[model samples]
Target: MKKINRREVLKKGVTLGIATTGLTGLMRGRAQPKKLRIGFIALTDCAPAVMAQELGLFKKYGLEVEVAKEASWATTRDHLLSGEITAAHCLFGMPFSVYTGIGGPAGRVLPIAMVFNNNGQAITLSSQDFGGKVGFKDLEGAGKAILAKKKEGKPLTFAMTFPGGTHDLWLRYWLGACGVSPASDVRVIVIPPPQMVANMSVGNMDGFCVGEPWNGVAVKQGIGFTTVASQDIWKHHPEKALVFNNEFFRANPEESQALTKAILEACKWLDNVANRRTAARVIGQRQYVNADPDVIDARLQGVYELGGGLGRRNYTDDYMLFHRGGQTNFPRKSHAIWFLAQYRRWGMLKEKPDYEKIAEAILAQDFYASVAKELKIPLPKDDMQPLGGFIDGVTFDPKDPEGSIKKYKVREL
Candidate 1:
């Protein structure tokens, strides 16, 4: 008999193990079948999921992943609800929004597996309005432009990707800080991220808040300019998450863990800075963002063109972060409660829903904790860290959700 190499032996053993399951396994720590569908939007932060597939990280963890590019945030949410995608790179607030009945059909059980990234999203205003006159730190100028347009009967429309999504909350907070009522003083509408620039270019909106590459794309087109990045609203704020439908999470515990491990590795790879240019190239491909790699890489590197002749600004401290030694991927329940409080602050909830209850259900800390341990990732001391670093002065206290709501002066409620 011919002697077999160690590599061949290991490969054959793995093949036999998979063949034993035969592409079928029940939930709860059992083997998962191949082609687990994962969804992502065409924004820059989708890099983690894309990279997981491209680098074979998913396969490394015995997960066969199909990274599906979603058309809109709404579509992504629908897919999550329908279980068409087992997991997704999702807005951190979206699962909360759906749970609270503020943005979707309501009572949907999507569990946030981990935070996909933080910061690097932005608020962009049309060149026709505040392009040269306003930039980051010029909310007063943006306010004035809104007033001028209001008097002129244009009323200065604004757009966000989804109601109660991260973009919506940022627009509402920024508008409120500008002394404009999001509910009454200005009309805020919903548009998908990829379509933000196109809508603004045809005189459809005055400003929009969306994820990157879109903001970068706008600058390249000269139709709109970024006023402030989302990090400007709250530096190092959580943006997107690795969210899975709760059914998939609860039923397939071990499979969920393996997939999370894969993405966590991918996130660590992305934060290396040297790989960002390569990431930009891969994610900017036609199947993903379908935008310019140079445009995408510029912002990924903290280099911004700041169009409308606003000049260049490089962010030394806060750019989009995927994994800063595992801090970026930890899904905290406090952040979930913070989003719930935003719904309360804006009176999106008829009566205050149980914030803690909702947060506990939606944020999969226990699941995340198990995966972090396996990967030897350091977890934060607590999930309930006090959130600060706002352009506005108010800090969110997870201990006092209602009190935090009252602190926002421009709130609808």
Candidate 2:
């Protein structure tokens, strides 16, 4: 991949030239409908799909898109596989899970269209459990407290959205960093994003890792305090993405490209600081995130109230971003390699899979590059690179994923 200067492209005022009309115009000769049914969970990251629909970007791109709100990540994955929905606002690691048959059936490959956003998800702990002052930096103390509770025959439980999703990875990494074995030292459960607050409110889990609005909602309800934002774990890390079934992508390549272009436009629109307020208001609707607009707006604007007397802070550098200098939307092969490495570390895979082959198979980097080029979006020079500068002072080299995993002492394998 050649590195194209995004600023130069923007300076030229280039638009999604052929993508806006090329595919849809050609499909007009056929009897197929231009309509598409897309699936999304009620989280702030779903903004691109919702905003694309609300702002008429889909229509502008000749796609009649129907945004379906899903109950959970599992349901979204199943719908995509069953062809009920064409694509999804999806977890970054989901396509890999589907490909490896971790949570779903084996021997199926799903395609990731593009990463929708980054740096927004968070880990939240119950304020009641920690007397209102525990966070990632205090994880060692938190771990000892959790162990003490476990010694009393009551094991502490944590929740993530899915078994092999972004939330699961963040929770596992955070726990492991603190010397708490996610598989042994605690009981981990799968909970949907919308259900996280309700479950925690009733004391179902001691802590949870989930996407935005919910984490902010937990704080609003006085149930949990924000331990750390995912960005704090790894700055600008890949979060949610747009994923499609391989069959769907093959059957409707033009339509897929059109959808991607629409969402990409939406992403560019979202990164603007001025649009944060409206974006929060729109995604907060009942048919979408179904949460208080103020709760969503706070984090969307990079304003935080950790709750339970943890204090408030403004984090311009560590907020959720849909497009930060044209970097957030590309689906890097390195990101997939990291996910596979973690799966191997935690015993999700029996052997080290061919990371490059799997990443190339699932992430549609070629298509993304084509669409990006057409839209004049700058492309990174390398598809694989090192992800560094973690809160734990650990570095992940995509070239040596196995070595990266070996460096961790708290993994199952």
Candidate 3:
């Protein structure tokens, strides 16, 4: 792991020659707001927003920021929509789900300001079922065992954070890849991230897919083991993103850009291996993730215990990354289209959606590009890219989402 100097990083960000060129001019003659309210859930991926508040990055950008730790993703969505908070550390699929009115009535479409982190979530299985036989490769046997249980009139249940969130998608994809039907073989339920371990301890479900710390906590408590880290399902997959209300973004472009820049710098600082320990400690405080720092730190450093005496292994490349070579932060339309494709594949949407149009509306690419250029962050040349391969050997083309949907053998559609 390479060491990082926080002071030097901050100096570079603050001293960027073009930092104040075009965007800052929008703030001229406008009264600077006293404070910006942001929301976050208790998860490891919320590091960027929490770190920005703790490390004074938000203040450094001449913004007084208030960070609110919310109880659930639903609360985060409601607050973001009702103007209680201007932006939030949001699930990647949340903005689109709300826009399309899948789980409920349609609200104002939200836009992703930037992607906060990627590739640290996991799918955990209860120890009681597999008897130490939990791994992605064993999903077929697991499905058989689940079928046997169902034959006795007890269906296996699995949980994810939200209906259309990344956790839900990962769990479904993994189950489908394993030749198990997510819709038929098991009962999929919704459980909050922080409550996942507790619920599993009470034997509420057979397994769950959620963000880190909880998965580590389950392993520590002797209740479950990780069947697969999400990265194994899809390496460098997009996870939580910094999302804002579209109306708020349009109404306050300058403030939005400033906030985005602050988070981008905070993300860069977080990627430094040297800062991870302290980052874990700060994020572990009561108002943030509120978990044991050691548990959070373990996964943050790419160290996995896997519980039940599975021993320890280090995974350097596939851990949670806030800013990895500046590739993680860009809000790519391709990623949005992929989510839309999943929604269509899983029958979350009634009919095929205008993939490009909805992606353009919900992902503020122009604003993100402007901020990236201002911060000297290198941008990807094109908006559309292949799904980049999956554990099931299925690749999706963003250009033909319907074709991607057709490739899924176990889709609801």
Per-residue C-alpha lDDT of model 1 across residues 144-237, encoded as one tens digit per residue: 8787777787687899998889999998889888878887767889999999999999988888999999999998999988888888899988
Q: What is the TM-score of each candidate against the true structure?
A: 0.91, 0.92, 0.92
- Winner on lDDT (2 vs 3): 2
lDDT at residue 397 of model 3 (Cα atoms): 92
- Count of residue pairs whose backbone atoms collide, per candidate: 1, 0, 0
Model 2: CA > 4 A from native: 1-33
Alpha-carbon local distance difference test for all models: 0.84, 0.84, 0.82
Instruction: Please provide, for model 3 over 32-129, each residue's C-alpha lDDT reduced to its tens digit, 9 standing for 90 to 100.
Output: 75688999989998988887776666766668989898888888888888889999999998988887887445756888988998899998889887
Which residue pairs in candidate 3 have backbone atoms (N, alpha carbon, C) closer than 3 angstroms, thus clashing?
A: none
Error of 3 at 244 (Å): 0.8
